[model samples]
Target: MPKSNIMDTYGRFDVIFKKGIGCKLYDDKGTEYMDFVSGVAVNCLGHSNPAIIEAITDQVQNEIQISNYYWNDKAVKLSNRLTDLSDHEAVFFCNSGTEAIEGGLKVARKYGKIKGGNKKNIIIYMDNSFHGRTMGALSVTGQKKYQEDFEPLIGGTTNAKFNDIEDIKSKINEDVCGIIIEPIQGEGGVVCADSAYLKGVKALCEKYDALLIFDEVQCGVGRTGSLFAYKKFDVIPDVICMAKGLGAGFPIGAVMTNKRASVLTHGDHGSTFGGNPLACAVGCAVLDELVDNKILDKVDDKSDYMVSKLKKLKEKYNIIEEIKGMGFLLGLKLSIDVSEFSKRCFEHKLLLITAGKDVIRILPPLNIEKEDIDKFIIKLEEVIKTF
Candidate 1:
């Protein structure tokens, strides 16, 4: 009944959340809801995790912000860990996924200029892919709805069909410098690029001397039962854009690059709040939980269990057309209106988010138990029956 000073950017529901722990959220009135959205794949370890809390507390007491002129141990440790975990050799830190996308684009363009000069600055993106909302990211993002208002985007960008290598080849040319894609399209109806298709893309990039960029902002950092989703495809990219789950619930982003794509030198790009001690400390804890605490090891089992139940729900409900995506980043492709269905689920106290127009995205915490998933299935079935 009252309006807040916050910008009306999101079509937010009326509920006011007060607290969260594990896979559940509590509203101001003490009503509990199952949080399957997990901050849209950001809370991989769940809300108020002890590891993350401790990391933040310890870092805050020592150092919160420092000039990038001098190195902080936390940032250095995180960079080393990230580079060690992935195929990358260098890292650039930012504050959000969109910032990460922006940095990756900069690296690609710089590499393009270095490799083939100004003429070879084209970036090829996949249709139905969702990269980010920033100007450069929006430019490469293949969805028209998000870009319609923000036209006159960055130059030399083109779109090719997802999972279509031939179409990608047709789009490629001598001036093309980069191809950026999401290994699994979380916001694009949960579409996944096939293994062969990714391999073909990599081959094409190699042949054309173009950099390959994987936007893993939503599906990376143990969300896909692997450290990186690109690993699942068995085709490595030259650059990886990561953010959502990197800092658990904290805001942090990174652009990692293999030796070939690490073109940016000193003063090429930077962020004042990027790689600050506080955020990198939280990122270290997330990585420790996923790698050392063996949290990533359990993701596949949880994914298999949840997907099985969702498949059964599809069999019973005519509204569900298909179950899409991999690992915790799954989706329900419905014949009904997804936005309305998501709103109904919200009323039912099951927090769900919709992808595109017809898919309800499921992005539960990576550490969520089978019991929580069981509860989600029950709530999902109850909502489906109402249709």
Candidate 2:
């Protein structure tokens, strides 16, 4: 291994990946590894997808980026598609999930001011929720481990126990402005919000005239067998913060808002590199693949196939405690050390990620085939036997 001047933020693996194809990565030494991580759910169509490549190539030949002062046709097309697919009426494009969250927070606060003056500025987040790592988003993220180092975060933020409607009811008041939640908590162990719990929270937000913001960064964009996770939950939110799979690894984010939550005026918030031609082209391509090609229709059957196999694995190994999450955003709650388990899987040429302390997050590509899944099971079971 050779040393370089990269940031020490991530504890990186020793392997140097040179290239990737569908559901697989090739190292510098020409070794192949099944990529189950999918760049932590960003590569929905898998690595080096044709649609993404074509979108990039086409947009690059014309123009890669243009000033925000002028409207890009690609951005307008993507925004129109997104709004048509969901209940949202408007869209604010950004560069990443955290930026989307930050913009959504500002929108919520402004809406609160408009509705009930400055007193209604409190934003409620859920316990164990992972919104983002930026200042404003970090303040709303419920995990103290991510917040403690950056103390004195933005004010007017409170939290309630996840899946506990009573706790949330006690937490909400007249001063509450908005409530942000993940339909499926990704970094918090792939735990899902109960349907009834989400409905109850929506009722409370409606009663208090507070905007309901759904952070679907990880679970949306057909990862949950639906365009938006809120669709499956049967609870429509005032704002939806999206990113991850939106650009299919091309780096884009958006905040979709309804009429009430669209409070950002002319000079409220903006992104310099956001909604550029190249990124928006990729975003449009991803949506076309998911919607026009009927890619989302295949998700539910694949989920059933994968979960059944995982349950059988659970029956076979005592270390496998439970299966959590939905569709492609699944997790294996192991009684053994999850980090060690993940490391061993990596050693055997399988890439994966860990959530919380004990769960192994399984985020495969949306377009991955069943043969690859079967191969993953075989490799996973082989790794388990070593433990």
Candidate 3:
């Protein structure tokens, strides 16, 4: 059969996956691969989870989607659940991480405009941090490569050095509307913000009357062994953008805020597909499993095991520079570029992804089995030997 024609945006991987279960995926020819990428950290509960399947199936049988103008029971339940889990008081659902970011940015800007005037519309973003691909989210993303082609980005965004309190202070001014940061920068080589630095940013934002926003799209939703990454640091942000793992494998996103920061009055922001019934049902199911099933407690144990295994690998292979990050959201800094290493692993029937140029991002399913980890290590060791 002739290959189906489609626009090739992503650098195509040689393997075409046909199905996945738990932490394993099968290619078109039925070759098995240990999936460490987990669709870039979207499958928190792993592939084809029975609970998620049942939830989605049940919701679809009734109402797959409905307009956002009316109330949906699933959305309402999910929102309540989210707000209860978070320190925040309200939730705004959207379709993806970028949409959630757009909602959060709009809320911050509108809050500043009404309270601090239009002059306080500036937003502080961190270098090497990623929010999403939409224009608003992309504007605040500090990576040049992603923003190179998209010139003349939305104005009012200032780049600050991550983990550098002084740099954030230098950027904050009377016009600054909010300070947005990733508590644990997932795409920026798995760098975690220092505790003092995070507290300092919060203090600066408070001093300037600017909102503190945490972009936890990758580090939130139990990925960090906590309900949220900011919670781990003991810092409270005014607004938080979450996605990736919120719905397990379902496409969903949310912008949550405290009472003071929930200033987007009626009609200020809206999404046609946001807060629909189907996604919310799946989200609630995922949250139930994460919370009630004690999945979060296991995150620390899995993370430690993975870290210990990676440390041993590092000792045997001088090519590995460091292993960083918390819980299952980890990255291995390699002395050599990760592109070649990632390709070698894929060839050996393991799926991995590269972050930046030198870091290998390991985002396996939160419930990845011990046996899968062993297989992943064997394949990884073989790839290292090839290097």
What would the TM-scores of all predictions be?
0.99, 0.99, 0.98
lDDT (0 to 1) per candidate? 0.93, 0.94, 0.89
lDDT of 2 by residue, 219-287 (tens): 999899998999999999999999999999989999999987888878898899999999999999999
Give residue 25's lDDT in candidate 3 (0 to 100): 90
Residues 257-354, model 1: lDDT tens digits: 99999889989999999999999999999999999999999999989999999989989889999899998989899999999899999989999999
Best by lDDT: 2
Write one digit per residue (lDDT tens) for candidate 3, span 18-38. 898999899889999888898
How does residue 305 of candidate 3 score in lDDT?
85
Model 2 misplaced regions, further than 4 Å:
none
Cα displacement (Å) at residue 384, model 2 = 0.8
TM-score of model number 1: 0.99
User: Model 1 segments beyond 4 Å from truth?
Assistant: none
Worst 10 residues of 1 by lDDT: 1-10
What value does the lDDT take at residue 375 in candidate 1?
93
